[model samples]
Target: MMFDNKKVDSGTIGYFDTQQENHFFDRKSARIAVAKLSQSISAFANADGGELLIGVEDDKTWRGFASVEDANPLLDTAFDRLKSGYFDAEFLNSDHFPGFVLHLSIERSPSVVYSTSDEAYIRNNAQNKKVTGERLDSLRRSKGDITYESHAIPASLEDLTNSETMIHFMLESDRISEPSEFLRKQGLLIDGNPTVAALLLYSDHPQGQLPHAGIKIYRYETSGEARRDFLSGVPLTIEGPIYTLIRRAEETAQKIIDSIPRLDQGSGLTKIEYPVETLHEILTNAVLHRDYGTRDYVHIKIFDNRIEVESPGRLPANITPQNILDERFARNPLIQRGINRFPDPPNMDIGEGLNTAFQAMERLRLNLPYINESGDHVRVTIPHEPLASPQEAIVNYVRESGRINNSTARTVTKIEQERTIRRYFAELVDAGELAQRGSGRGTYYEIP
Candidate 1:
C-alpha cells in the first residue's frame, strides 16, 4: 500500500543500530527462513502493529540485500501472510550504505492473523508468543470480530415480555411493537431464547443468572497498598438492570467521596471531591463497554488520595491507552444502544466520555486521569492532587522550608528528570527569586 520509498540518511542508519527492539519494533537478517519471517508478521498483526526491518543483522550491523531481486522472497512472504490493506511494504536505501533495506509495516488486524503454517502468534514485549485454547478465543473477543454477548441464553418469553424494565423502556422510546417483536427486531432474541444483552437490560434480577455482572465499591483509608485493616467497611455491591446499576453506583460513590476530608493550604479543610461529570462518564464507560464474557464485576476502589475504576477486558482492536482519546471501538454494541435509549442516558455524548472527563480535570487545575491495562482489566486512576507549574512549586517550597534541594523539588513538582528541574531552578535564580548555595548532590536553593 505504500507508494513512495523512504530515503535513509546516515543518521537514520546509526539510529537503527542503537535502537533496542521492543513491542513495536524488531530487526531481522535477510537470511531469516521464510517460515520464521511469517511468524514475525503474524505476531505484529495479532497485537499492536509493529515495524520489521528485514536487512538488519542481530549484532546491529547493516547487512542489506545485494539488489531488489535478493529481497523478493522476504517481501513475498509478508504479503502472503497479511491481507492487502493490513500491511505496507517499502524499501529503504541510503547512499552511505551498501544495499537496499526492506521495511515492512504491519497493522493490527480486526481479526487474528495466522502464520503460513496455520498457527497463531501474539506479540508480547519483544517475543512472539503462541496462543491456543481459551486465550485464542479471548484474542478474538478482544478484537471485536466476535462477541460473547451475542450468545443466546435460555429463558422464557414471558421473562422479557412481562418485565417492568422492558415495558418502561419500550414506552419511553415510543415504540409500538410488541416486546417479543422488538427483541427480534433488535437481534436480542435467537432461536426462541434471549441473548445476554436482553437479559442484562430487561431482567429485574440479572445477577441471579449473571452473578458477576455488577459493581463492587471499596473505600480504603490509606494511600498505600490496600489491606484489610485499611478497609473502612464491608464492600458495597450494586446489582440491578444495567440502567439502574449505573445510576445507583454513581450516587453511592459520590457520597463516599464527599465524606472524606482533605486539608487545603488556603482553605484549611475541605471535602475531597472530583468533578461529578468525570465520575459519571468513567463509571458509565466501565459498565457499558466492559466485557460481559469475563466473569467479574467492575471495581471502584476509593483510596485516600485517588479513585481507581477497573473495567474487565482489554482494549479492543487497535485502541490503546495512548490513542483512546482519538479512536473508538464498541465491544458491546447492543448494550450501548439499549442504554442510550433511556430518557436521560448516562452516556450523553457517547464517544466523548473520556475526553470530557479529562477536560473537566484541566479546568479545575487537577491532574489528568491515568489509564493502565493489567491482565484482563483496564484501570483509570484519577488523582485528587492538584496541578501546579514546576517554577511555582519550587518557589513555594523554598518559602516554607527556607531551603530547597533537587530531590525535594522533584517530589514537590512531580518531575522525573533532574536536568529539567535544574533548568527551572536556573530560571528562578536568573529572575532574582532564589540563590544557589552548594554544588552537585548537596546543592540547595534559598531566598537571595
Candidate 2:
C-alpha cells in the first residue's frame, strides 16, 4: 500500500489482516466483494475513521503472488472502477508483501453514501443491507423536506420584532452579507413576516411567543448539590430570545469561571490556563443542535469544577457519541444554516468541532470535554482542571472576585484583544479556579 512502511516489522503489517467488526476484504481475488466492501467502508467512515486492508488472506496471512507484473494490471483496473462510483474512495498498493497489499481509506463527507445503484445502505455489524423503511421514516421525521427555519409556526409574522432581528444581524455583519436577504433566504421570514427561526434569532421576547424557546441556567457549589438543586430546588431560568439565551449562558458561565481561586503573582501579567475556544465550541454546539420539538428548554448547570450544557432530545437517528465526530447528521438543518451566517460560525466542518474541543483541551492540558446521554437529553461537560500546575495568580483572582470581564483580563494578563477571555475564565471556573459576575461592560472578575 502507499502507506506501507518497509521499516515497519512484519508483525505490524500482519496486524492489518485482523478484521474488526467494521472491516472486511474480498474472500476471492479480482471479484469485487460488494457487500463486504460497502459495510466496511460505511462503518469505518461512520465510526472513528479506520483502515480497510485488501488483498490480504482471510487467515491473516500474506502470500506472495505468483507474478507481480500480472497482478498490477488487475489492481489498477479494480481501483479505477471503484473511484468512478459515488462514494469517495482512495486506493493504495504496498510492495512490502511478496506480491502486494491493497489499502483503502474512506473519509466521512457531508454527502451521504449510496450504492452505485443510488440506494442508501447501512452496515449492521457485518451485514450490508438497504436502509429500512422505518429508518427512512425516522430520517424524514428528523428534518423532512422543509428545515426547522422554514417551518411556519401557528403565530403570525407580526408577533416577531424586526428591530431585534436587524440588531443581531448588524452585530454579526462581518459573518453575513445582505442581512435582510440572508434572513429571507433562510426562510426566517414569510411574506415580510418573521419566521420562528427569525423570531428566535432576532426577537427580544421570543419566549413570550414560543414559550419553550429559552434556556435555564443553574449554579451549585458541588455536582451532587447542583443535581439536587435542579431536581428539587428553584431552577434559575432565563427566558427570552435565542441571542439573549446565548448571552445569558455565557454570562452564567463567566460567573462560574470567577469562582476558581487564582494564585497571586507580583507581575500584572496573569497567564490564562484554560482553553476558551473549547468552551465556546461546546456552548455554540448546544444552542445550534438543541431540539426545538419539545417544550422543555435547554438547561445549563454549573458546579464547583464543571459546566454541563443539557440539550433537549436524543441525538438524531444514526448519530451516537462514537460516530458523532465522523457523521455530519444535523437535526436542525435550517438552524444550522442560520447560525453559520454568523461571523464566527461555530465549527461547521464534519467531525471537526468535537475533535477540536478534545484536541484543544489536550493541548492546554485541561480536562477533555465529556459527553453524556440520558434518555432524550445529551449533556456535554467541560471540566477546568485538564492540566496540572495551575497558575496561582489566576486562581487567586478568581477566588477573591465574583466575576471577571474581558477588559480586566486584558489589563491584568495583557493578552491580545482578539483572544477570548470569557472562554479562559469559564475554563478556570470549571476547574475550580475562579468565578464571574455582571454582564456586558459592567462585567468583572472575582475569586470563587
Cα lDDT of model 2 by residue, 1-448, tens digit: 3323233455666565454545333232323355445544544443233445555565655643354444454444334333333233233334555554445555432234444454545444554556646453332333232244455665555434346655666665753555566666666777776677776776667777678777777766533533442332456777665555676776666755665454446765343344666766777677777766555788877665577888876566456676676777666766666656655555455346677777778776666777876755788888867443334445555556644567666554545553566667778768866656777668666665
Off by over 4 Å in 2: 1-10, 17-19, 23-32, 56-101, 122-155, 161-187, 190-196, 203-238, 252-285, 288-299, 310-381, 386-448
lDDT of 1 at 42: 85
Residue 166 shift from truth in candidate 1, angstroms: 2.2
Give lDDT per model, in order.
Answer: 0.87, 0.57
Model 2 compared with the native: what TM-score? 0.50
Residue-level lDDT of model 1, residues 17-41, one tens digit each, is: 7778989899999788888988898
Error of 1 at 54 (Å): 2.0
